[model samples]
Each structure stands twice: as C-alpha cells, then as structure tokens.
Target: MENREESRLTSAELANLWRLYITENLMYQFKTPLIDNCQDPDIRSAIEFSRAISEHYIVSIENIFRNENYPVPTAYSENDIHPQAPALFTDVFCLHFIHQGAQLGMSKIHEMMAVAVRQDVWEVLNQGANDFKDLYQQSLQLLLTKGLYSRPAFLPPEKESRFAENKHYVSGWLGNQRPLNALEIMSIHNTIIQNGISKAILRAFAQVINDKKLRDYLEKGAETASDIMRELEDWLIMENTNVTATLDSEILPTETPPYSDKLMMMLIANVGVGSLGVYGNALSTVFRRDLGLKFMHLMKDAVQYAQEGLHLVIDKGWMEVPPQFPDINTR
Candidate 1:
C-alpha cells in the first residue's frame, strides 16, 4: 500500500499529521463553547485566535491526507461542543486556559517539527509553530495586562559567577544542607503553578460531568493536583515566598457540562501526560535529594492517574490508533 509517488508522505510525516489532527479536533471541541460563552472581550479574542489556529491546522492537514489518499482519522465532531451550555469557567479562568494552551501548543509544535521530514509536511507544521508562537505572545501580553498572569519569583542579582564546590551540592541527604538554589526554586515554583491550574481545570470538569465514574476520577485527579501543590507550597513557604493563586473561587456553579465525558476524559489524559513531563523535567533540575524524591513520588502518582484515564479512553473507544509500520507477522 506504500505510495510510489516522489512527494508521498513518510511514516513520520503521517504520524505528525495524525497526532495534530486529533489535537486540533479537541481544540475545536473545547474552544467553540468557550468562544460562545466568553464574556471578556480580550479573552474571547484570544480564544477566537486559538480556535482559528486549530481550524487552520485541521484543514491543512486534511488536505495533505486527501492528496496522499490516506483516510483521515475520525476525530471530534460538532456534537462534542456545547456552546449553549452555561459558562463552566469564569472569564479570568478561561483566559488562563487559553494561555496555558498556547504554551503547551508551542511545546508540542517543537516536538512535531523535529520529526517532520516531508517538504510539504514540514512547511505546514513550521507555519503552525509560528502561529502558536504568535498566539503565545499575544495571550501572554493579554494575561499580563489583565493582571491575571503569575510571574515567577524573582531572584536577587548574582554578585558573582560560581560553581558547586562540594559533593554535597549534588547530594544533600547527609550533613548540613544548603538553601535551595535558584534552579531548584524555579523548578518548584513552575511546577506548583502548573499544578494549581490543572487542579482548577479538573475541579471544574468534575463539578459539571455527569458520569459518576468519570466525575469520581476527575475529582481524584484534582485531589492529586492539590496534594502536589500543597507540598510545593510548603517548599515556597520555607523560602518565605507567596504561592500563586488557585482558580477554585473562579469556577462557576454550572451543573451542565460544556463538553461530553469522553472529551473531558481526553483532555484529562492529555493534561495528565503534560503534568508527568513537567515532573520528570523538574526531577532533573532539582539538586537536593529530598526535592528529587518528591518529584519522583509526584511523577509516580501522575503516571498512575494518566494510565487510568487512558484505559478509560480505550474502553470507551475514544483512543485513536496512530500511524504504524506494517506488521511483519502478518506478512
């Protein structure tokens, strides 16, 4: 079934297209409702832009698939969006969601562009990356203007360049431990902020979702986020720094869901994987033994939760199979 055409899509190109197509579908499903219910002009504009970006990617990728004669995977449909539903999140919280989405989009674009080889495929993904970059900048500026953006804790100017002088810098488990360095502090602060936002999203989803099992699972995910945030907060408090704001007070009492349980579970799974990545990255940056151990524990819990969500996605048949190599066993 391999295409003999000179411009035929490579397996990597097909995989990237498929992955982003699924993501764009989720974007459409999530953003349409947000756009309809969004009250803040600034937030609405950003959501519109974000939604447009996804829509553009979807159309562009589908064209590539069409030209290549590969059947596009079935993704979310219009039925997935509930625009008439009451606002599940406040304007400020919605803005936060878009901002975080932009950040994650940029990260994903980098991953996608890395493996893309086809000229046409790389062009499309590169353009998508630039679009996300612009969206990230715009959303960030809007968040800052509205005073909703949480800036990382500032460190004092370094008086001089220095390097770790002792083995204790690598392992602080024994003897006298040094205060947390800027790198360690930055990791803790960033992780706590991410967990806070994730908790808010999970809390809102849990409140509106009807399926008892999914709702219960979403609540559990929120609790896990809260636990991790509390531990991170303690570390920040030890440094006498204030923690970032949580959006719990901002979530509305809307009993109706803006998205279906299936969509919600998919979002949960996506965010769970991102959370695990953040923890994994932080583990590498943390210098203290205790801090590294803490990240490991949090990562373990996040992985377990993500696996549960993925299993549900599979059981419900929401998990789309990605492009794969031909099976030699059958051959």
Candidate 2:
C-alpha cells in the first residue's frame, strides 16, 4: 500500500491547501472586527465560534506548509487590518456572513477533500468541514430565531409525478414561462441570494475605498449586482415565489475600512469570479433555452467587470502571483 500518510504533498494537495489557507485567513481577518462589533449575544457567540474554527484551520495549514518546506502564502495579514476602524457591517450582516460562509465552506472543503491524496490531509479537511458544518447549523438557527433569514420558496408536494408534457416547459427566464421546477427554483433562489450578498459587499467596499477609480469600479459592480438580482427576482415573481432578503441595511455607514482597499478589492474580485462558476453550473442544469442564454449574457458582463478589477489590482501591485508551473515550452 502506498502510504500517502507519509508521502510528499502532491500538486493537488498543495494547491488545495494553499487556497484553503488564504480563505481561512480572510475569514479570520473579517471575524475579528465582526466579533468585536457584534451587538446580539447569540450572533456574537456564533461568529466567535466561526472565528475560533478558522483560526484552528489557519494554524493547521501553516504547520503543514512549514513541514513541507513550502513558503506560506502571504494572502492577508495584520497589515490588511485597521485596528481603529469602526464596524463596517451590522450584526445581522455578520451573522449572515458566517452562516453563508460556513455553508459554502463545507462545499469547498468537500471539493478539496476529493483532491487530497494524503490521509493526514484528508483528516484536516474533514475536521474543517465538520467544524464549519456545526457553525452553519448554529448561524442558521440564530438567523431563524432572529427572523433574519429569508426561507427558500416552498415547493408544494406534487399530487402525482408526471413527465414533461411538451417543449413549452423549456421556455426561458422571461416571457410566458412555465412554473419553475425544483432545480430551476433552487437555481433562481441561490442566485438571488448570492447577488444580494454581492451588492452589500460592493456597497460597503465602495464606502471606504479612497481611490476614485476603485470606488467608481465598485459602485458599478454594485449596480451590476442589482441588475442581476432584479432579473433573478423577476423569475421568482413570475413563479409567484418568495424573494430573498435585501442586505442594503446590513452595510454600515462607517467610512473607515476594517480591511485595506487592496484586500477588499481582491476579496470582491474573488466573489465576482466565483459567481461566474455558479452561473455556468446553473446553465447546464436550467432547461430553458432562453434562461441559459440569459446566464450567458450575465456571465459576459461579469467577466468584463472582473477583468477590470484585475487590471486595477495588478496596477496597484496588490495581487499576489499564484503558484504556477514554469513555461518549459519557451525553448
């Protein structure tokens, strides 16, 4: 048996660990201020729980990196944190962030775990997944108790299962479309919620950024988020479904940033890039011809905006170079 437990880190394990370290580091940075500024005790406790878990993961991965003789990624650090900065987001938003982040983290951990060859690596990823799953449950319970979470649109139980009657059922995102099936409804609700979060993040980042060009760029992104949400919500409306919560009020008026402008830009860019994947996945699942086309249109705009943000980050020298294989084909 190949003892992966003692084996050298494969490229996949290295890459996943690097990505997870950066992700956990970002969460820890945000969680510190969030925990300090949180009002409600329950929410504060939940965030504290999340922060603790994130710290554990951060230390774990750092140790692995050191053991492997791999220089740790300087993703974000104390340099990015502003000690005197006031609350940049509300308590509700903090809870929501933890809730959504934990939920997403579980999925991410599983993805990493799939690529992991080492037994030790699996253990770390597994533990991280379990920890975040608990946090997800905790944050969700609090959001439900506080009436903060917008429940997904209810799918009425079918009296009897039946096959699609005709081609009309494949009608798209607009016009006289048929009622949404389960996957379609889930896709719409998830996209709406994601855009809502994106809008709030952009608004909050726009408030603290000092660069006029960056601020203008963030504001435009926020507008794009609004446009995306509006179209997705229209789908819900057409199906007579419940829309997701608005996060505008969650953004605080603090002009002071908790994170550096560079950090915020990179973080927001990550969000934009991630959504493109979600849209692509949705395209494959959503049966409507026009609905797929709509995703194509939205994805095109998102790609452009993300490219613009990338240029700004590169210009500022804030973007870190990712680990890459040297181009041997140059010869």
Candidate 3:
C-alpha cells in the first residue's frame, strides 16, 4: 500500500489526464462567456454546473502534477478568451454545446477509468464520470423541455424475426436495396449533428479572423461539412427521414473575436479527430456498401481539412509539445 501510494503515473493515466486538461481548458473558454450571456435560467444553471466542475478538475489536475514534481500543462487561460466579448452564440446554442460537451466528457471519463491504476486517479475519474453523467442528464432534460432535442431518425419495430439469407443484404449500390437499420440511421443522425456544429464554428471563425489564408482554410472546412451533411441528408431522405439541427442563424452577428485564432484552429483540429473516429465507426458498423463508401469519402475530406489546420497550427507556433521520451539515438 505504501509503495502504491508513491508510485509514478501509468502511461494511460498520464496521457488521458493531459488530453482532458487541455480540452477542458478550451471548454472553459467557451463556457465562461456563454454562462454570462445565457438568458434561459434552466440552461444557464446547467452550464454553470458544468463550468464549476471543469474548474475543479483543472485545479485538481494541477495539484496532481505538482505532487508528482512534474510541470503542469500550460493550457488556455484568460489570455486565450474574452469572457466579456459580445455574444457569439444564442442561449439555445449554449445548451446544445453543453449537452454535447457533457457527452464527450463522459466518453473521456470511460477511457480514463478503464486504464487508471492509482487509487487517486480512480477517485478523480470516477467522480468526474458521475458528475458528467449528471450534467448529461440535466442538459438533456432541459433540451427536451425547451423542445430543442435533435432526435435520430425513428425506426419502426420489427414485426417478426428475420435473417439475411442472401448476399444482396449487404448491397447498396444497386436497385431495390434494404432499408437502413437503426444503427445506420443513428450514425447518420450523429454525423449530421456534428456537421451542423462544425460548419457553424468554421463560419463563425471565418467571420472574426483576419488571416486570409487561414480564413480560406476555415471556409473549406465549412464547405466540406455542408457537403457531407447534404449527402447524408439525401441518404436519410430516401428513408423518409429529416433531422433538424443547429442553424447558422443560431450564431450571433458579432464580428468580434471571442476566442483567439489559436484556440479556434485547435478546435477545428479536434473536430477532425472526432470526425475520423465517428466516420470510422460508421464505416465498420454500417451494413450498406454505399454507406461505407460514403464514410470513406467523407473521412478523406475530414483528413484533408484537419491536415490543413495542423499545418497552420505548426506554422503559427501554437502547437505545444507533449512530454516525450529522450532520444536514445534510435538509429
């Protein structure tokens, strides 16, 4: 027990904490202003709750690093954001953002706990998971109350047990194909939702940033998101489905920059990672041949957009180095 208490951090625990620290910092930047400008009391309450927890997590992680005699990550701070800036997103958008963030927070918590070895790390992850779960529930309930929840395409119940008796079950590029399964529809639903947010973010960033080159890149991301969303919507339309999501109008008319360009670029780069994972999962799980091809194409575009953002981040000298192993002349 004594030895365990004094042990160094495991690789998984260290990596998870590092990623969470930076992501949470970015979130804090967005939440700080949203919470201040939010008009809906219910939405504001939930955002406030989430922001408080994020602040606690940040300080807790800093203490953990200090105890380990290691340097705490220099993540975002006040300099990276202007909490008093003009409104950039509506209160409804704030609610949706918090809802989405809570979902991501839960995902991170699961990964954090799965590989956590130390008892202290487990405590933090466990508590964080429970808190995020609560936040998720709270935000979802608020969305439902406000009639803002974007549900996936509804699938009818199976009338009887069935089996795929032929190869045509997997075919999608030909005539008279099988209807989409719940999983496939759900995947499309999520992709549309993400594209909605990503496109809006790119548009917002493009409006505020002055760099012509990066603005063009941001516009490309927005266009890619829009194109993919339209294709996915067309697929859903064949099945008599329509998904209503975040609108471009949900963004305010403010031309002022709320977050630094570095933060905006980082957010886009993170979207690239999230998009690849979402598309990859859809590719593997979706049964239709056409859907698989569609994800592959969308994944290619996502990769290209992300690559551009990464190059910009590197060129701007905004990319920070993570802890690395010493070069042992690996020749």
Candidate 4:
C-alpha cells in the first residue's frame, strides 16, 4: 500500500476525481419524472448516454484513487428534489434547458482541458470533449429532422439589387438625440428580463449537470448574469426609465415539443448558441463601455456554450452532411 505522506494523486488521478464528481451529481438530477417530460427521445437518450458515461467514469476514477492509495473525493451527496416546490416546466422544456446548460459546461471544460498540466489528464479531457461534440451534432440533426427548430424570424431582403440603393448610417454614441424614449426604455427592460430568464435557465442546468467543474462554472455564470441584471436595473431607475421586466409569456411556442427528450435538449442548446450573436450585437448598440464590459463577459460565456454545443453536434453526426468532392481523376 502506498503511504499517505506521498502525493498520491497524480494529475490523471485528480482529473478522474473531477470527472466522477460531476457525473454522480448529474445522475441524481436526471431521474424518471425529468426524463418522461422530455419531448425529444434523442435528447433523453443523450442524457442517458451521458449518465452511463459518467457512471463508468466514476468507477474508473475510484479505481485510480484506490490504486494510488488516495482517498476518493466525495462529490455527489443526495438526490434531493424539494417536496414543496411545484414542477417548474414540462419534461421537454426541462430537457431543453439542461441541454443548453451542458453546452455551457462543455465549453468551460474545453478551455480548462487546453491548460491542463498533466498530459494524461489532457488526453482524457480531449476524448471527453470530442464526445460532447458528437452529442451536440446528434441533437441538431434531430431538430432539423423533426422540423421543430426555430429559424431566425428576421430574414434579410431577398433581392440583392434592392439592397444596393439604400444606405443609412445611424449614429448614437453620445446617447440618442432625444432623451431615451419610452419605447427604448421598454426595450432595455425587456433585454434585462431576457437576461434574467437566461440566467435562470443556466441555474437549472447547473443543478442537473454531472460534471463538478461544469456545475461550478455554470453557477458562477448565473451569479455573474444576476449581478449584471441588477446593475442594468439600477441604471434604468437612475434615468427614470420604465423597465418591462416581465418576459412575453405568449412568445414561446406552446405546441407540444415534437422530438424525444434527448433530441429536444440538443435543440435547445443549438438555439441558445444561435442567440448569442444577437445578444452581443444588441448590447453593443445600446450600452456604454462600462455596460459594454459586462456584455463582453456575457459574450464570452455565450461563445463557450456555442463551442461546446457545436462539438457535441459534430461528434454525433447530427449537423448537415458535408458536400461530396468531385472526382479529380475523372475530371
């Protein structure tokens, strides 16, 4: 037996501990009621797959800890779904929310994996990261196949010639010429509420996420978003602005989600990633440097989520098929 005095935990060992910590936590969060409510079977499957992988990882990590004569890290504790709380959403919506959360988690993992000190740990992370990429791709495919994915509502004009004649540059760096109008104030308030909703979504995912590192990262993101929302509200109040903090409940589709639980979750991740650019541009247009800095942070988080979601999609062969190359020899 290895002595306790020795640094028994190698980089690989530590990495496994981190992996197991996240997976076990996730297993509890993704139970039958949660699974049953999912609209997409593919999404449900993916979650199950993730759970299985995590379980395997946990076992592997425990073995490593045992071999190294190190005490295994205690990560997962209880499967406590509070009795008092009402069900917040249907299974489909829950899956979708969780999927977005996973994207965020994967993104954080990719960055940390890049800077991992141990080669073995890096290798493990690299493989796991690729798995997430596959998952993302599969989710996208399911969305497309089911025709449930939401396309960007605002489409540019169809005729290229029509765009050539119209050119207008609107400038508002020093604030709008007129004092911020009611409409503009309302828009700002709407944005803040949207931000809050997104933060809540992240928090929900963090609760169910299997990875400790990912959970920690997501929790941090939720906190950061909450802070930004508070600041935005404060600014609105100072300007005597009327903020419409409530989300438009009628906007989101109420139709039963068409896909399986797993697939639906994947779809949600894709949508969330797709929305990042819009958020980035919106903030850039309306906010000053002080506010802009917070937006930048938000952008960073969005990019991370997008990258991870994309990785999952690609790995799963769910994205659009690449075009076939012409036969050079025949040509």
Q: Write the per-residue lDDT of candidate 1 for residues 1-331, one digit (tens) a residue.
A: 4346756777777887898898888878888888898888888999999999999899999999888788888888888767679988888887887888788788888888887767778888888889889889989999889888887777788889989898888786777778788888888877987887889889999999888888888899899889888888888887777688888887889888889888888887777777877888899999899899999998888888888888878988888888787899999
Better candidate number, 3 or 4, judged by lDDT: 3
Q: Candidate 3, after superposition: displacement of residue 105 in Å?
A: 1.7
lDDT on C-alpha atoms for all candidate structures:
0.84, 0.85, 0.83, 0.51
Off by over 4 Å in 1: 1-6, 327-331
Task: Write the residue-wise lDDT of candidate 3 on 50-110 in tens digits.
Answer: 9977886788888888998778888778897877689888888788878877877787689
After TM-score superposition, the amount by which residue 30's alpha carbon in candidate 2 deviates from its true location, in angstroms, is 1.7
TM-score of each: 0.94, 0.93, 0.95, 0.46
Q: For model 2, what is the alpha-carbon lDDT of residue 155?
A: 85
Per-prediction count of colliding residue pairs? 0, 0, 0, 34
Poorest lDDT segment (10 consecutive residues) of candidate 3: 1-10
* Candidate 2 clashes between residue pairs 3 or more apart in a chain or in different chains: none
Q: Model 2 TM-score?
A: 0.93
lDDT of 4 by residue, 1-331 (tens): 4465553445544654565444444443444334544455776786665555445556655665577665665533332333233333544444444444445446755766755655545665666667667656665565557553433222235564432222222233454433333334543554465555566655655555454554565566667667767776776766765443422231233223222233323433534543474455556565244444555666777778667655655665544332234789998
lDDT of 2 by residue, 62-155 (tens): 9998988888888888888887889989988888778878877887789999989888899999998999999999999898888888888888
Indicate the TM-score of model 4. 0.46
| Ranking of all predicted structures according to lDDT, beginning with the best and ending with the worst | 2, 1, 3, 4
List residue ranges in candidate 3 displaced over 4 A. 2-6
